[model samples]
Target: VKRIIALPGEHVAIRNGAVYINGQRLIEPYLSEPTLWRGMTLDHEYVVEPGHVFVMGDNRNNSSDSRVFGAVPLSSIVGKAWVTYWPPDEVQVLTTPAYAFQ
Candidate 1:
């Protein structure tokens, strides 16, 4: 699965267990449960550098993403996953979330 959270030059931050971009809180309605982000970066504010992105897994507790490996270069992203067909029983088309940025 590929997650495109923060883009180059975007400011990402975590406060009270939620994500904020460019000082606006991001709304992720697709999440099955709330995210308790405890990533490798503890600076509170993460300014995504040029040609890089910040990635993370839905299962924050079990995911090791850019938080651990640092920002990922834009050149490395292959593509986005448009559908989910795993677990056999659970399969469906994926739609992009409309994050409420304030």
Candidate 2:
């Protein structure tokens, strides 16, 4: 799944299938083109509310997330997803993107 690379109050957008934040393109080396945004419901015009998170899946086309159900309140985020314990090949510690904190 994709991570919460950016948070509330951050401007986010998808253009030509690439993600950008605050007027800068995000360096999502993990993703390739054809990253489908099939089920996304969060239009770029919507502002992420304070204390809420906007999340999407790595497999963009198939995800059911904030883009569909709207931003997730920070209170609803029970904990951070620290590791991928399942799928041996995908297991690793999660690193929040640096731009996410800007």
Candidate 3:
């Protein structure tokens, strides 16, 4: 449902159709396609305020998230989607992606 993009105090921006943190680009190997942001206007860099997190949708261009609603308060997070239940044969557990900004 939601993908955590940038944590509090981190800088988040969409540049050249890719996500960047601080001044380094994030390696998002899990994404099947590159992000195509089309929701809100991100003409300027965004700095995540304390106690807030920047989130996005699995479907970037069509999803509304922090880019549209602004950063979400950390306290709003209740749980993470850990597994898929549909398609009995395709059931599986999901783990958060490890990002290395470089």
Clashes of 1: 0
Instruction: Show where candidate 1 strays beyond 4 Å.
Output: 39-43
Error at 10, model 2, angstroms: 1.5
Which residue runs of candidate 3 sit more than 4 Å off their true CA positions?
39-43
Query: What local distance difference test score does each model get?
Result: 0.78, 0.67, 0.83
- Shift of residue 20 alpha carbon in model 2, Å: 1.5
Q: Of the pair 2 and 3, which is ahead by lDDT?
A: 3
Candidate 2: lDDT over CA atoms? 0.67
lDDT of 1: 0.78
Q: How far is candidate 1 from the true structure (C-alpha RMSD, Å)?
A: 2.0
- Count clashing residue pairs per candidate: 0, 2, 0
What would the TM-scores of all predictions be?
A: 0.85, 0.72, 0.85
Error of 2 at 25 (Å): 1.0
lDDT of 3 by residue, 1-102 (tens): 798999999998887777888978888776767675565454457899999999988777788898888999999999999997879898999977777876
The residue-by-residue lDDT of candidate 2 on 29-74, one tens digit each, is: 6665544445553345446789987787877777787667777888
lDDT, model 3, position 14: 82
| Models ranked on lDDT | 3, 1, 2
Clashing pairs in 2: 2-57, 2-58
Candidate 2 to native Cα RMSD, angstroms: 3.4
